[model samples]
Target chain A: MEKMTLSSKTREAQSPTEQWMRYLGFPGGILLFLLILYLPAGAGLSAGAQAGAASFALALVWWVTEPFPTYVTSLVLMFLLLVTRTSNAKAIMDVLGMEVIWLNLLAFILASMLVKTRLAKRMALWLVVRFGHKASWALLAFLVLQLVLAPLIPATAARCVMTLPLMIVVATIYGSTEATPNNFGKNMMLLNLACISVLSSITMTGSSANLIAVGLIQNMGGQRVYYMDWMRVGAPVAILTMVLMWILGQKLLFRMKPEEQVPQVEGGLELVKKQYELMGPLGFQEKKAIAIFGLVLFLWMTDIFHMRWFGVEISAPFAALLGAVIVLFPRWGILSWAEADIPWHLLIFSAGAYAGGLALDDTGAAEWGVRMLFGGMNLKGVPFGFTYTVVISVMMYSHLLTTSKTVRTLIMLPIIITLAKALGWSPMSLALPAALCIDWVVGLPISGKPNVIMFSTNQYSVGDNFKYGILTCTIGVVILVISGATWFHWLGITPSFWAVAP
Target chain B: MKTLRLTAFILLASVLAMAVDLPTYTVRLQAAPDGSGQGIATIALAGCTPGTFNLPLGFTAVQDLRVEEPASGIRLESSERNGMTQLKVTLPPDIPAKATLKVSFRLKQVFQIVKLKPGEKSTLPATSRTFKHAFVNTQEYLIGAYRVEFLFPDGLMAQAIREQLPKPAKNEVGPRVLLSKVDGHQAAILQFNKLQQGDDTSMIVELVPTRRSFGWLIAGLLLGGLYLFKFKDLVATKQP
Candidate 1:
């Protein structure tokens, strides 16, 4: 009961900005909504699109400000979408039934399996024993782990589920809890979050959005972006940006003092090592948990071959569901229904955010918004370097406004291709580089699936997230700009910056 | 018996599929000098049977509708339902599999007129009034390549314009989109490879009258001559 009370108190605790936002956020959202709604519509912007944009603006304000709980704000946004005629009733409600939400739900159950079976504790102890001497090394170790898993597990949420328990356990050992989080915990959790998102851009098969981009480039641009071609360009930019983010995060953003850098446990590294030794060999439950997770990972890794081998593809959600069913099976499974740790609030928040985003998409607001964005630019005779920089920046930062990477790709790539055709520049020159930046959805908790999962840990505030996220994004933009001028020019992905189209 | 039923179903499905095999669908919209317009849709169908097929003209309130299948010599009896023209084509039993259908109709309004008042706006003088011609594909299917040609009346200059995303603070700018010339008229052509059901493919362009440019030139010359006449003494005093 005391523990429950402490956790609840932690939930209620808000930062100074959060407190002020909650106070003013409600009226502020309404004012922004009215301002955008009644403003003179731009070209090609229908009334429906205007209303959709207004509704999305209000939701974003409320979400950032926490006028209510984030989930309640979502509920309000969903209602606003309906009443404003931005989206239909069925569409608003159907967001909960989306496959991403289902994947998150089932993933939480699998996450519970790892934690409940003591398997997570074992792995956490092992990680701590190996790299827990300093918090920086421990963070780097998880970073490496994410890089290794990014190519293997195409589903980012699945990777987060597998690693979330380890993060939590290791965080507690470093003296960070849900009730009381320290810089070590904040840096650890947010770094892993950045890694999962940024590393996905390193490979062509990193995410489904990457594949969609490839298809768009091939069909619309008539040029194919081979897997190796993507990795050749994508790997260097993503890796260098991640490393810079890691160093800057610790040294600058969420700085850890010398005392905080070391393990805060009573006995430190030796104690963590002893604890791992004390756990002894893998027990029945650990082995069972491993077997289940191993099978799930195998299925995830072999998704490309599922159609050829099994005649049907088991998507990420279904594969996780399969594992969840076994994990909850009668007496044989590792966890029971009561022991499963699923956060319905985050799921509701996710659903509402998605509903709001889809409303923007369905009402043609998103497309109109992108069109107006490019239409306003005077890139007629601009140098290729300047144009490339603007395009890459827009693509990298657009994740802040969108919820789904696939929707973003669908809307963005065509306009980009069209813009390339309008200009004399090659379509692949702009669209390919833009496609490489699709997975940089690391700006907010509502930005991506793994972000929501990581946010639910309550280790960091939204302010911390925005600061770290925006900084990381800026770093990524800078690296891409530099690379586009140098490395990409050498790679033939980009032509000379001063060269005019023939 | 099950196999026979399946075979029959497959054959019927194939025949129905061939009924709407629109390999080449072209729509040409011609805007006359009097703010009125006409639309001609030419569709090429392959392996079609004798049946009634409804073709949507994407305009509500159409006038003088005509439909003809040239190859099969089938005259269509038409009626309007749900904003589409349902044509009942009666083909002979020995008709060929391929056919070409042509439908022509007059439209209510093709362009919205924007008259420019002299000296009303500071930046752009009363040079030309633009007519905005917009075409939206209202069909609920993926149009592989929607070839639309907008032919303005002769001596009117046309430039296809594209709307940009919204900027709250900045002034509006309609960037010029690439257009092809069809018989000396600016033709706004769009390809809808990713168009989905209920999704609109809009092509917007601004048509300026060439005579207005000449009018502006005459006005400028008269103004310059008047200025010289009115300020001759002042100009001579200042010139020394």
Candidate 2:
């Protein structure tokens, strides 16, 4: 194992053409901003809201192309809103400190603690060694391990990094090195990437994109989707997807050799065991970190129960912050301020995006955009089942066109909610399911951060990802549709196709 | 001869009551921290004889209806007609002249988180927590006065108050208390002397964060930090 710096692993040098394309994003955003501001306001939207629409457009362009750092784009968007009087300074500033932002910050801090305490490494090794008797079992072991780590580590990329070394070691043991990749290694790596990305959909705070989607839903006059509700709707689908991916990878997609069926390398399990032993033993810091996070998870899952008994509602973000504060407290805490890996860039981007969403809703720009884009479709008369299927499919396949999950969510969710409302359907029925698709960024190498990171492993080609990725994505869509119609129906999330609209 | 004279006087009083109009009713609402409220409706019938008094409530499931008047103890019955909950108080046969009735009951009140428009600034302090309480008019007749006093939760300080209604005289229930506002609603804080009718009222109150939450936050961080330092070696890295 080698020591790795976070930035060095994630950052790649840009090509001249790519750099020029990124530079184009700035003027492109400015042009869009001016175009939206000058366009004739219709549908009874206020001028302030129209201006807000301009800032949202600007942010969208920059977010998609990355002319500036995502956080810098966020800051620029806020400043534009202030200058254009789209929103007041207080409102803009207040958003930066919102509880959701803190939640993301806290989640990052918790992830950092896990990394620093070496708890994640230890947990991964123990799972692999315990479940690595057979090739199929080893693959399932990694799949299960990634799912377990999904909720605890919010960043998909971070999870990939944590598990990558173990994966390489396992591949080497099977004689499936990167240069001569075997069916087993391809299956393991591809499934590893796919499962990590897919599992993020199950937890409310599993990914930053999920949080942004929730925020957009709340901004659109919908009730907050708590942790329990998200899990109930998303977890079954995620589990089913993982099952299908495993079957496809093991039997159908990647052909395994007889030698691959069992551990051929004598010391493979020893390697993992050695890594586990290196951690020495769980110390006080590990115990404390575990205890604090355990409390956080407890509070998050039982928020409603606690609210009933204690009269104070413990929101997901607040619970996370509570855990983070304890973990970062000086002298007794596991991490110092400098050690905490809070992603300010992502937070700033979120704050700006939230502000833009607020402006859109407040200024009636979203409503207007909804009217313009969907008004002529006559979607109201369409059958609920058909409408729902179309919505889910669009959300699933949209990953092919964009890279950033947050950008995808920020653009799609508001429109989806507005369209749902316009169609006289419940916003949650459409928006929440659509939001779940934010994690399905697996259609292409450039579709998501995790996909990109996995692609860089050199074990699989673009053709490999596209072939398997499309198959599983199609299967995932089917599973999601089934859940929306049956499971979601049972939960009263969606009414039966012929039932009266809510 | 005395008995005959008393009967004639009673009959004469009953006839006089038939000509007098119903007294005006005033409702005062006090909101609690847990989102429930207590309301007192005072009926002033200074010159009229007691008869069937009907009170319509803006909210439903009225509970604990306590009436103070009619020494014989009048029976109170509730019925829903035309989607409205009406409380019917049957006045005693031997009614007093120039009487006032006080009716108090408990009703559930909903508070919503305040939504600010883009670029709209809140008057509440940055650190103040806020919630909005709405008062709707369910009565058909004009109300003499509508007053509301919002009680802030303990450890929270009321920094500023905003109301939906215009030109309301603001006062403290004790000292330095503020209320919140809703658009197009009128409500008076701490004082109920003003006369308002038909229009709905809402109030928003901003409460400054108390040391309790801050203290818990700080204390939890410090304690957890200390615990980590004590057991820090468990996290020490070992490269294999």
Candidate 3:
């Protein structure tokens, strides 16, 4: 198992849907595009709007089925938007320069700082050594580590990279490997994946998708969502979802035996401690990384006080940028320019998705579609709970359709905002909760970056990931629904009892 | 002598037996981005006569009115009526009596400085332009079909507000229902089939311009270039 290559682990059996999509997704996307473009529908829709919808349809199908790499599909999407005249060349090209894209770049830089100094691994090792006496405690240790690292490191993939080796070591101690696996490994791997993905919802900077949602709310909904505003709603819901997922995985889904719960290998607990001791004491670079990360986290948390403290507020991107600048500031900084692990391809993907979404909006295609949808559904007299539930469920489960959370965010949030506005509900009321669901990208290996990393471990099968992922997502939907009625109501993000539309 | 007189009178009466029939008039009104408008009216006439045909142009403050035969493309200026502009078309003496003529009347500034009423404020940045264009059959003779089209500017995206208007009575012929074809190239079309003499049809529309801008494109390119040049190798290895 240890000698197995990464591709061998990643090349698991494909589900029927994936197989079909792999074969026919490209041509199917083209067909859909042509059909929507030439169809004599919606006499009131503008030519630009019609063209925008067609371009988006093609991109959506291609992104979901993945006929090409998602980034390649995105490049194609950008080209389509320009050639189809759905959006101007300048607008489509400018998507790479959006503030959300910048924030994602700076965030990866900050993550690289933590990873370069090995502070992330050190922290994870310390937690596991402190709490790896039992299998249950070990899992909780990882969960806690994820919660700790989520805000400090905005990139989930980076967090997963830091902890993957540790998870592999601990799984081996439990006598679980690709050749021989057990319930303990399944629970361990799946729970950690859920943790890394779900805990990201706790902060607005947790993912690129969250920031895009915020930008849409500000631009389209005319409501600015501050960092604290997101945390005020997102933190509770995400933490609860993580806790429930842990419980469901340990107690119900993957129950370990008494001996399996303990380390099956000799001196398993000692091994973790030995690993922690091998790291030795925290070095000067680790200390510097901590101080910089701490300052950044402090500024992020204390944004509400910035206006009173210094007569101005430091935005999330600016805060991350300041930290990144220090991390690369001459010899005093920890990393050289080359050391920063910025994924230009992912940025390209993000730019194209943003361009498509903005084109739909600029051409009024998104709004027109939303209006037509509501007009057809006749949701005027429906109760608010039902509507909220539908919106929340769709958003939470939308990971099954598209793998990229950034694309999903660009596709859904504006329509959700428009839907809410069309229905006379507050856009934030629906969009914020949906935005909180952006990081629940754990339903498949291709669902998220972290899932891909964790899946490549090969300690669990695709079936295990799927079953556990679907159950965990359903559990998440229930938690969010209840929170929408109770916790969010108490926080006033939603109405109490959902008595009346806003 | 009496037989000769009867024959000459029969010829004169045959020449005097000219009649005119107004079948349909389709008017196309196009609005410019600068708030000006132009219109083209295609009028179908049968039973041609060598006499003047007074066609009422249902527009206010019409300017640069020009008429031409659709088939021949021959430009001709028709006399206009004061107060409410009417086209005075003179049929030629050599026109075949059985031939139906199609004449095109082109008018500029048909909607001169239309005063668009302001609508309610919305969360969107677009401002609303609300106005009404009335299509009235000012002719004394009944019109077979009177069609009017109001078109928005090219490449402009807008949303039509759903304003409720009272339905026409069952016994009465209210103006034909307004069909807003703002989608694609279709305009807001109003068709009044068999419009009675001097009857008018009008509908109000509120158009909200939904144009969006793409600023900071150059800035994006600069940043992207800097990243590519500074960390170009990362792009090869760190592809997501």
Would you list the C-alpha lDDT of every candidate in the order shown? 0.74, 0.65, 0.69
The A-chain TM-scores of all the candidates are 0.96, 0.63, 0.67
Number of the candidate with higher TM-score, 1 or 2: 1
Q: What DockQ does model 1 achieve?
A: 0.02
Per-residue lDDT for A1-502 in model 1, tens only?
0011112122443455555555566667776777786575443544455667888898888777664677887888888888665677898899999998999899889888888778888888888888877788889999899999999998888898789888888888888878778888899889999999899999989999999888877777778889899999899888888888888889999888787787677987888888889889999998999999998889999999999999999999989989999999998998889888788888888998899888776656776677768878988878888888888888888888888899899878877876776778888889888998899998998889998878877888777899999998898888888888888889888888887665
Candidate 3 has an lDDT of: 0.69
Candidate 3 per-residue C-alpha lDDT over A33-125 given as tens digits, one digit per residue, 9 for 90 to 100: 777765654655655566677877777776666656556777988887876556778888887777667776786677667767877667655
Q: How good is the docking of model 2, as DockQ?
A: 0.02
Identify the candidate with maximal DockQ: 3
In model 2, the Cα lDDT at residue B232 comes to 42
Best by TM-score: 1
Looking at model 1 chain B, report the run of 10 residues with the lowest lDDT sum: B164-173
Residue A438 shift from truth in candidate 1, angstroms: 0.3
- Each model's Cα RMSD: 16.0, 17.1, 17.2
lDDT of 3 at A274: 79
